[model samples]
Target chain A: MAPIRTAIIGLSSTATTSWASAAHLPYLLSARGRAKYQIVALCNSSVESAKRAIEVFKLPPETKAYGNPQDVADDKDIDLVVVSTRVDVHYETALPSVKAGKQVFVEWPLAHDVAHAKELVDAARVAGGRTLVGNQGREAPPIVKVKQLLEQGSIGKVFSSEVRAFGGTVDREALLPGLKYFTDRAIGGNIVTIGVGHLFDQVQYVIGEFQNIQSQLQLQRPNVLLRDPSTKKVVETVKSNVPDLIIIDGTLAASQIATDGANVLFRFRRGQQFPGDPALSWTINGEKGEIRLQAFGGSSLHAGSYGAPVTIEVHDFASDQVQKSEWSWQSWQEELAIVGRSVGVLYDKFAEGEFEGAPSFETALVRHEQLATVLAGWDEK
Target chain B: MAPIRTAIIGLSSTATTSWASAAHLPYLLSARGRAKYQIVALCNSSVESAKRAIEVFKLPPETKAYGNPQDVADDKDIDLVVVSTRVDVHYETALPSVKAGKQVFVEWPLAHDVAHAKELVDAARVAGGRTLVGNQGREAPPIVKVKQLLEQGSIGKVFSSEVRAFGGTVDREALLPGLKYFTDRAIGGNIVTIGVGHLFDQVQYVIGEFQNIQSQLQLQRPNVLLRDPSTKKVVETVKSNVPDLIIIDGTLAASQIATDGANVLFRFRRGQQFPGDPALSWTINGEKGEIRLQAFGGSSLHAGSYGAPVTIEVHDFASDQVQKSEWSWQSWQEELAIVGRSVGVLYDKFAEGEFEGAPSFETALVRHEQLATVLAGWDEK
Candidate 1:
């Protein structure tokens, strides 16, 4: 009720061009979401940097600024801990806070692998704390409406589904110092776990779940160029062990297409956004109706997944035409607009206590397990 | 070169609704194609019926009309024989003509089984006769353009492909006397061979062939309601052995998606159409670009495959936008317009002798064999 007192990790003092400043800080600071969240504490690499964040982000002069996450975790005033550090350190930053019984929210790729993700989930359960992973792909309005349309039988029985996604972290032709680690497969933040993983989670959210699947992953761009963040120029070329292409094909747990299984297919590619193609496209085929959703926002499955309106269309056998829904499905919120909009949705749902079961630790764990299944032959590929 | 004198088997006197009157006769009659083909003979179920076809089709008074295919085959004036009878009878009707050394074109599903198609090809080969089968799906202009685009590297290094098709003969809820035979799987003109086959052929025409594949077929619509040919009302019910859904997933003979294989997926369902959705949709995703083709013309694999334009769009990393080509890809050639357009394309190409290889009798035989591979577990389903 008291505006869940918050502490966001790695709150940069330099007013850096970071996701926290671009998405998280502005979102919680906005007048609209202000009533539900209040930043009480901030942490950076050093006490001096935290002090800079307080001034740059305009936190109250009295607000606590700490050099370490443990100091924030020790502060009894904070009710929530928001982890926005690099993927490699997400487990370390969020573990102590969750262990201290604070509701915790971690940016996706909850950890580099299923083991790390499970450990985080286990820690939260042990501490009796709540969790929210940054899997915001399904929180977008068009995505939410798809769930509604399916429930309303806008399309009779869904027989099959398909999804196509392109462009994400894999597009990092030359990355900054912080992002160089993402090119390593062991880090678990590459396209496979973060990009395809998020979209697949959204698919499961909209339709159902995958009962069985066969998957393929390929490293099309094996050599990744690393750049100095300040110079914005390539400094080193590293071998990329992560796959840039991802494919999953199989049956959905429930389907109108068949009793044994419903046909579902997915394909994802990285470092590629053909000029003018929708960033995300999906089709749900049904017996009596059909639905399609596409986003041209250059929306990737990773950290930044939005820019334009997520368009939704419906077609029924009776009308025999694809009718773009009239419902206003756009979020006009300016910066980080698309992903921000969905993040806002999750915040609202959390505020209303409707998201208690998920974006929760358990659901995130299940997705992690599925990603593990897809990783079975990753080494061989 | 005085226009190959032609005989069309099963030319219908019922100008009211025969496929011959609607598609074949009008197509050949059109001035554009007339220079290449001059109808010299017509044949139907009986001599009386053949005379009716001559009257209805307004054939020249000197044109020969025969009740039996053998009589038409025996005519020395006929240089090419075209068979348009039911699938079950195609083998018999086209046999004598092929053996007699006439250039022959048999409607697709050259027979209900592989053996018959092989026999037709064998007879044509031994007689040193040219052959064409009415597997006209690829002949469509848009389809032709797709092939051209792929060859031009519109999408570089094709990594994967997906195709979805719905609506066709598998929808036989009610049987018209003439079409009741389609409800029988033994007839082999059902969705798997006719529907998936045509689309797959189009794929081959564009992207080469599949080196290996796994397939699934389901009789979702197992029992069809028989109907009066004229009434359009259900009059009886019959068992349907044919599958309404077909699924194929495999590696292409050549792919840019991978070194071992580029992923390819195909799914086809029958008697189903979402109001505004295209009847057939395909996407080619490549390393550098992507291409999508969607036909709304309710374009099933059977006789009539359009209700809308076959839309084509290409996306390249250089362009980064989906550019729909501006081409008059539609035909106002009403009866069997979609199929007719392709047939016209073939006729023009055939006129120039460019279609020397296929959809020849031998090529059609290959497709029938593939369908046979799909039909292996038909009884269980």
Candidate 2:
């Protein structure tokens, strides 16, 4: 199958070094016997940053270095645009691409707030462009297994779920010299907007739609110690309005009526500085069984090890027995590698006419709408 | 101090075997140097049950037996009335005693609904009688340790709290026989009104008052199997309307600012026949440190030896260290024994005048009001 010519907006480190280079690029470039994609252009506010990212990520030598999002969006060679930019610029960068009739995959949190997200979703619909926001968790192996188990009645009916994700504070000292906007509440820096936002999307994707939400968002440390990116010295203090901690309780309508109901309790907080622990743990309970995931905060999956093994247990009602399984992902790279493999499978399915008539655009739009609602709550003063 | 003459109303097995013999009688009769109470009478729906309780608990020869609550309340020597009757009879048995100027300690729920509870509180207030409804958890040892830690700034300025308590269905067979009222929603049989009620009381006692609550309550199982008490046979089926699971997201007033806002998430559920595991866990986050308690439920705490341990870890900012503690209570009886020792100390302090004129009754009434508000939400159709 012909490769889907792809372009990327925003030449930040995450774009060049994180998901873009590690997961997206590898999956797009290496899926044998599957529909292929090629990165043909890179865009940034300055051509220099684009050129730097192109060199760092080893894009084709002929790839264009565009100075702005519109320049890349106007290129007819690009069939898909991947937006990995500052959350504040998501709508601005992605809207042009969607309007120009290209498929789009923006990172989690389509916009800083619901209104802008809705605007982007509406534009994609009118332009008839497919959208895929980066809630890559939907492709995770454990989640995929959980979904299959639910479909097969492994856990009779999922009545409730609890998810927790915590990590030490993101090291601001690591960002570029002038990228403080990422830490600003006005630009969406907090557990509610970023962490739980992704979790809710994943859970909703598997179970169903959320009917309502009641949440308590907290700014645990209002004043954060800022440090210089170059010297790593205390620079200044920035006031934070975004919640470092969030707790949400809500219901999800299950597909089957025999299933009692779905209850979700989620908590996310800034990581603790204490030793011997990473920050994330999740548990999902259905009528038949439960699955739990614990991840330590870091770019590495191994960081979450509590000197104990990670295990999954299943209860079989028919046999009246419980079964257990264990597997290890040595690093965050490995975890992302698993997700990347799944994306390849999806792409292969798409090429084999499996999704030729699938409602990819409509399904993605539904996810976008929910993301908007979360942002609306997040942006409340 | 001279012992205050006391009487027990409702001579059930829990009262005759557990409360009367194991807790109240032993404490009242042999609590030397700290014993400030004595049994004066025993009351039940019938003289036969009262006499049988008197025999089983080995009451003093002078202690009288009464079939009517008013008969006990009319006795000038009866200074305190312990209402350990079925929930439906709590108001009937305790109201007259409180109105008759007797201190009353009623078993929990206060009444079937908030309205009845409010009436009891008002009657006690009007008659100048002290009331301590049986939320004995408020006096538990571990809880006391937690409270002392918070008070002493072991973990400074609590900002968030997560609490979960769950268990298999309360033996409907054990509780429903001869108590048709147990199956009625108006009588408050299921999880939310009963189990979470106890949890909320304990939480409020330790934390403070909730400012608002958003909750989802569900009756997961529509029909529950009922068995014959004497024969131990499956004899019937009972319909359940009250929620088997309850989840709430709330904001609480800080112990300091009265409005310093603490975020709270709480969940209580019946043991799922399939997917659910019986468990209880709590975590509290403060400005300086965090404390976590996990694995807190089951018939025999040791019944699920394969489960995780109950752990308490504290991170102290002043010391720049994290400390850990763990203990196992093989049964609920052992857990209650730990509770008894803690309350015994408080009772000793009270008798020694450590809390002289401390307005303990007023503070207790305030807690009762909070419970009332929580129950009012559940009362809504």
Candidate 3:
């Protein structure tokens, strides 16, 4: 019943731009969040930075500060170890905590690849510790509503689903200076692994798992230009090994909704959404009707960073009518940062012992494996 | 060129429903069409039927009537043969004309199968006669405009394209009385061969051919109930062997527009258009911009029967501007039937010696082979 004492790695205080500062920190600091979670420690690259974050965020003076994952893992007082560092370091930061038998919460893309993710899952299983991966799209308000609609039979047996979306990038032409690492495939934080991965996961959450997949991942833009956000000037140029275009088609495993299994097709391209078009348009065609979800912002629902004014429309064939609705952050959670709203929802669901919205590390591992399958070859059985 | 003395097969006159009556007849009867072609003969199952059609349509008394394809083909005065019969009869009707060394035009699907279509293509090639296949999507004003926009670099270096459209079926639950044959896979006039096949052709015309394709053809609805149009009562139930759902993903072949190649994904389902949503929504993503086309009707641009209120939007990232436009029939062609408009365009292009819009029999043969590839398996390299 006691609050799960938390230690957040990579928590930053210098700027509000980082994911830790923009999303996780805001939610954990909120009044409602404090009732279920208590931030008792801070872990940064250095003890000094951890002290600085504690002081800036105004945490209790008794909160412990640590510089390394080992220090956090060694602490007996912390119940949850949150790995919120750069994607490349996820394995290093979380492996010690998982082995230490502490509940671990890592951001999505659990690691750079499936192999590392599998290791963490294996360790968690052996240690018998609980795990939660930050795949917030499953909890994103719009997606949740769509799942509810499908369950309610607003549409009949789903025959197929299609998604055409724009990958996350405020400026399609160039990356931000510090975010240039997103262009590297090895880092595993690029579009294919993160952007397409999240969308795929959320779609499966709504429909079902893909039975078999065939995908074409293309590095359409090999060279990526990095520009200073404020100056709007090119700061650097990086060779992008990651694919900017992803095309996937497959059959879904049978689910209650699609009893016979459904066909799935997706097209994800790295670019700004067209000026007037939705950044993400997903259509699920069913026997009697259809459900369409359109987001005006880029496809980052998993990261809780999609732009607002999102809509879900249900078209019933028998009546020839369309019901339209929009989703927004809960009024109580609106005080939190925009990108933190869904994370707050995930936390709320976690507190209620619901893993449907905030899935386990094993669930995230399956998605990582699917991504690996996509990258391995065009035909994946 | 004395109006390219022509003979039309299956020119029905009792009802304004058949493709021959709704599309072809009106086009050829128009003033501009009259200047390019003349209907000198009529061919039906028998001379009595052909004579009745001539009388009903008010054809000149001198217009010769023929009982069979052989009779039409043997007439030395006929320089062009237009075969507008049903799918299963296309090969039989068009083969004799091709062998007679007369220019031939056949309704799309050309035949019930790839082998049959190939034979027609081969016969035309060996006989040294000009040939045209009715893939009107290529010439649909909306498609033509989209192609022009792509050529103009309205959307720079293409990265990918996606199409999610509703296949034509006025009633989602049951088929019309005379359309029971549409449920038979062997007939080749079903959703996969006709609906999806036509959409694929138009996309290829706008972008490029699929270098390779992976598709799932599913018979989502097995037993199709046939109903009388007026009564809306089930008259008979037929077992459906054709796939009602089609999902395809592939890479576009290198073209001037898509220099390197682009990813293509399509999802088509047999149903009515979702209310308040575009029946067909297609997006072409490029390096600098994107082009989107939406039709309120069905995905029958190839049959020149897409429901109206179609729009094309070009979004330029640099300017953050969307240029919107709508396509409609030309003023002169407006007097003709709605479905006849695009057919009229094809006729006009053919008269101007332009094969781009009105593709050749060989071109249609390639599409038939692609459909065969989709049906054969999930992977087509």
Best by DockQ: 3
Which candidate ranks first by TM-score, i.e. highest? 3
TM-score of chain A of each: 0.90, 0.79, 0.95
Q: For residues B1-381, could you state the per-residue lDDT of candidate 3 as single tens digits? A: 668789999887665488887888887898888999899999998998888899998889999999899999999999899998879999999899899999998988889998999998889989988888888778788888898888988878788888877865666568887888898868778777778878889998889888868777777778888989898789998888777777787787677789565778787878776566677889888877888898886668766445466888988777888889667667987788778887778777787675545688988999999888888873332
Using Cα atoms, each model's DockQ against the true complex is: 0.28, 0.39, 0.58
- Clashing pairs in model 2, backbone N/Cα/C closer than 3 A: A155-A288, A156-A288, A157-A287, A158-A286, A166-A279, A167-A271, A168-A271, A287-B275, A296-A304, A301-A332
Q: Between prediction 1 and prediction 2, which has the larger DockQ? A: 2
User: Candidate 2's error at A121, in angstroms?
Assistant: 3.3
Q: lDDT by residue for model 3 over A165-206, one digit each (tens)?
A: 886566666898888889877898987887888888899888
Higher-ranked by lDDT: 2 or 3:
3
Model 3 has a DockQ score of 0.58
lDDT of 1 at A364: 78
CA-only RMSD, every prediction: 5.0, 5.0, 2.7
Question: Which candidate, 2 or 3, would have the higher DockQ against the true structure?
Answer: 3
Q: How many residue pairs clash in each candidate?
A: 22, 10, 0
Residue A190 local lDDT, model 1:
68
Q: Which ten residues in a row have the lowest lDDT in candidate 2 chain B?
A: B298-307
Model 2 lDDT tens row, A285-370? 66545555555533112122233434456765445576764443334334334435544444444445434223253454565565
Number of the top-ranking candidate, with lDDT as the measure: 3
